[model samples]
Target: MPAGDSWLFEMKYDGYRAQAAIAGDQVRLYSRGGHDWTRQFGFVAPALATITKGTALIDGEICAIDQHGRSNFSLLKTSLDGRSPIVFFAFDLLEQNGEDVARLPQAERKARLEALLTDLPADSPVIYSQHVAGNGQQVFDAMKAGGFEGVIAKAPAARYYGGDRSTAWLKIKAVQRQEFVVIGWRPPEYGVDNVRGLFLATYEDGQLVFRGAVGTGFTDKMRREVHEVLQLILADGPLDVKGMPRAEARACRWVEPRLLAEVEYTEVTPDGLIRHPSFKGLREDKPARDVHLEVQDA
Candidate 1:
């Protein structure tokens, strides 16, 4: 098929991005960053071995679905405690049989992928990632209502542009929400400045962006707990701002943004600033840098 400008869009799954390579009877799973996670997902190796033809390269997410039909990352992480079955939602077929399909138009590749999955067991871990024909906005809205992370839009005929954040593939995230390590605090001016607001920071593109501080949405009890946590990490020095911290009328006291807290915000401004963010709660699982902004779409 001749490649065109038409693109095929798919749901931006909210799990780990993985590439499954099936050659003969052997299967190897590689993370997007090129790490081998096959041993971590040992339960999926056999499922992948079912591919009977030549080498096949599949790109998708390794997610665990709960009884409620929702993707649960926390469950996956806990269950695996380093060993669990992982369902691979295959979204794209980069190679099949003995042919390399990465250079083919997306529509053709998708058709081939659909045909390949049609005869698989109904409840197989390997399933297709369905796409909307032309209603991108509808899919986007549906994802939001369902609490999904986001949607990716791809040119129907665009070839695979590996490791490139090309405009050809666009991502539209539902909302920017993550748990960040509260390395420091900025006190509100008025009454008891036990800990007015929190300093938020996450790593992105290898650079740290202080996503501004959040003071709203804190209960008195939550404030006390946060104050205790910040007290231990307290250091006597001005907060480090590779870039100047944007301050509002709210008087502030700076601390090391070292503790982790869950936060939800509307979006990231063009200059990498977060807008209208509010504190959610404390998160103990994730590290500081791992809390960075993620582009949900392509």
Candidate 2:
């Protein structure tokens, strides 16, 4: 995490990034990829509508909270099938009273967002994402100890760069996690499910490169569900990827690089492969082209 008084640290949620636009009684929700998901997240829209009587734009995450009140991505995937309730953790206010406030400093935006959510009921679906001006190390340690995802360190005086990745915001994870494009797959050796492992890839130097494979962290039901989706997007041949082994290439089934997979790994090898990687879930919030190995910037 960044060490300085000018930095603000907030809890990094393990959930889908979403934006809510409120215009009077009309509240529309959009995904990170700019897809309309108001219906998919019907449970959270009503709470957003109650935020302002005029108009406002809020940016936050839609997450499924576990029994311990921590955001859980696995639970979120299950909840997508209409199994459980979800919450919207509002973190920033982009537009207030129909006026664009994105150019405002990060600290100012967060303060306005908190104020907008202050009148929400105790059991409201939308909650403000609180942050600390400093003490990043202390917060990260506490989050790690509590089995939370991680912390996001942001420059308090920096403006919001919407739809653009910037150094003003940094993600510091307790565990290593990344989003990889699903390039290929391997059939289960001896199982009812069609998929056993996913061959992953990430963008490097403006080209797609073979990262590695992830076979673990899938439940029997999830395996079956994911296999169904993979079947429809089969490709005639693999996309030309740098460092693909010929032997493994002949053994795998290639697919269109439209699916994004969330993966957790212990570390990266010297040759640019992920170690001890496991599948977490499929991510639809982000475009596959944006999947790249994250690095800390100075």
Best by TM-score: 2
Tens-place lDDT digits, model 1, residues 6-104: 445577664566889899779998876577888887677776787666688988888867666766554565556644445889878899877889899
Query: What pairs collide in candidate 2?
Result: none
Q: What digit string (tens of lDDT, one per residue) describes model 2 on residues 1-298?
A: 6887779999989989999999977999998889998988877878788777899988999999888989988788778776666899998889988678999999999888888889999999898998988888999899999999888888999889865368888888899987899998888777566688899998776788998899999888888888999988999886888887887687788999989999999988888899999889998898787778876332
lDDT of 1 at 294: 56
User: What number of clashing residue pairs does each candidate have, in the order they appear?
Assistant: 17, 0
Full-model lDDT for every candidate: 0.69, 0.86
- What alpha-carbon RMSD in Å does predicted model 2 have with respect to the real structure? 1.7
